[model samples]
Target chain A: MAAARARSEERRAAIVRAALEVIAERGYRGASLGAVAERVGLTQQGLLHYFPTKEALLIAVLEERDQWDTGGGAREGWRLDLLGSLVEYNAMRPGIVQTFSALLGESVTEDHPAREFFTRRYAQVRAEMAAVLRAEYGDRLPGGLTPEQAAPLVAAVMDGLQYQWLLDPDAVDMPAAFRDFLRLLGAR
Target chain B: MAAARARSEERRAAIVRAALEVIAERGYRGASLGAVAERVGLTQQGLLHYFPTKEALLIAVLEERDQWDTGGGAREGWRLDLLGSLVEYNAMRPGIVQTFSALLGESVTEDHPAREFFTRRYAQVRAEMAAVLRAEYGDRLPGGLTPEQAAPLVAAVMDGLQYQWLLDPDAVDMPAAFRDFLRLLGAR
Candidate 1:
């Protein structure tokens, strides 16, 4: 039973990785289940046995990315400096960033499946960022804005920098620019 | 001859508007030329007479957006204050923003048609942003970085804030966040 379960888990992981590549190459709206299934050498029905639906597969892909970023929910103790480190880390992984950005860009349409996921995620991210800011700068940052007010900007900079860097890597150094932003935030 | 020219221009403008609506509803990759043609009351062959190709139509839509934002090349005098106003202006036009963002997101995918347009546009935008910073801050911003160094971050903040705002309008006040960013830039 243990060995059988291990094989199933491995297969599921493979499918998720394949889905990421397809989504990266084509935006989520452009990626099809058959394409993902073909990449992993499975029939469409075989892939469906694991993900059940394309939306389910997309959610799995997103969850897998978060796991990679947070090291399995290790973000509980993330600080502002740690966030800088995360930006640096992201620079090395263009494929993952491309997929995330593509999905994020597509999700703003009227009724995208990922719309709810990104909305909830951004809300939680803003709250977490506010916590990080408060822990680092007390209630008010140096510019006289509260942590809650500053959190969304922090999140925006990270996300926005990714799009620019992905489009023009040589011109926009994501990590260096992010450090510059941190300086702006820390300015007295 | 003058009347014919005016009618031609009007028809082209109508096609661009329909293309924008279609692209916003479905991402560039998911959007079909036939759908855009139908929306504009043209057969696909008739739409081809104006745009020639889907890529051409996409560029026209993008150019139209720039015209709206710049008031037909009046961006030469844009300062940081003016940029903040642009953000406020953008909030009122969610359809245009959604179309631009969708194309931008999809353009990052490999071999996407709009990739070249976005790449060149960012380079131009970054240079323009540098000029704006230099005009305001001379050699160095208050934070001590040169205008050239700070330019990408400014652009990133505006683009990034838009994504956050589009995803959750209730959570992110785009104009207010942009003002806070401007304050951060002017901080000593």
Candidate 2:
């Protein structure tokens, strides 16, 4: 029984990885379970046994991406420099970044399936950024604003850089621009 | 003859407005010329006479949006306060903003029709932002960086805020956040 469960978990992980590839290549609206299942050498029915629905599959893909980004480690304790490193890491994987950017853009609509997920995630991200700032520079940052006030602005810079970089990779150096932002934060 | 030209120009403007509505409602991939024509009380063939193609319609919509944001005037001469007002104005029109954001996101893909348009637009926007900063602050801005170096970052903040605000309007006060960014520019 233990061996069977391990095998099932491994297969599920494979499906999620394949789903990310499809999403990157075809975008969320274009990505289909049939394509993802084909990529993983599974029949559509077999994939459904794990994800149940397309929405379930998308949620898994998004959750899995977060895990890769945070290293499945303690994100709460990370400081600004660690966040900079995360930006550099994202540049190395354009496919993953493209999938994320596309979904993020689509989720803004009133009725997108991933709308609540992104909204809640961003709130959590901003709160965590505020905590990171407070830990590094106390309640107030360099600009005389409280950490809470600076947090969303920080989040915006990170996401904004991703959009610009994805649109014009050669013109916008994602990692370098992020480093410049770090200088703005007075962290460098 | 002049009256005929004026009437044709009015029809073109109406079609662009209807196209923005279709894009906001159905997204770029889902939006169709037929739907836009229906909204504007024309057949698709009549709409095509004005736009030539759906891509042309999209370009017209984007250009019109720019005209609204900048008053069809010199963006390089605008100050931070004016940019803040544009953000406030955008907040009042969520559908138009949504259409722009959705298209911006999709344009990042490898073969998206709007890819070249967005890439070129950002290049122009960043240059204009740099000029705006330089005109307001001379050689350097608050953060001790040249306007040229800081332009992309400024553009990123504006676009980034739109994504976050669209996802969660209650949590994100978009105009207030933009004002904070203006403060970063030392405009206040």
Model 2, A75-183: lDDT tens digits are 5778789888889988887777776777777777657887888898899888888888899889866756678777888888888888889888888888888777767
**DockQ values of all predictions:** 0.51, 0.47
Off by over 4 Å in 2: A1-7, A20-32, A52-56, B1-7, B20-35, B52-56
Predicted complex 2: DockQ: 0.47
Best-fitting candidate, scored by lDDT: 1
Could you give candidate 2's per-residue lDDT for residues B1-188 as a string of tens digits?
Answer: 99999999999999988888787677665567889999999988988899887777877898898987787876886886888999998898777777778777777766888888888889999889989989888988777667877888888888888988988888999999888777766732
- Candidate 2 docking: what grade? acceptable
The TM-score of predicted model 1 comes to 0.86
Per-residue lDDT over B25-78 for candidate 1, one digit per residue giving the tens place of the 0 to 100 score: 765555578999899899999989998877778778888988877777745568
The alpha-carbon deviation from the true structure for residue B180 of candidate 1, after best TM-score superposition, in angstroms, is 1.1
- Model 1 stretches astray by more than 4 angstroms: A1-11, A17-41, A52-55, B1-10, B17-41, B53-55
Chain B TM-score for all candidates, comma-separated: 0.83, 0.85
What TM-score, computed on C-alpha atoms, does each candidate reach?
Answer: 0.86, 0.88
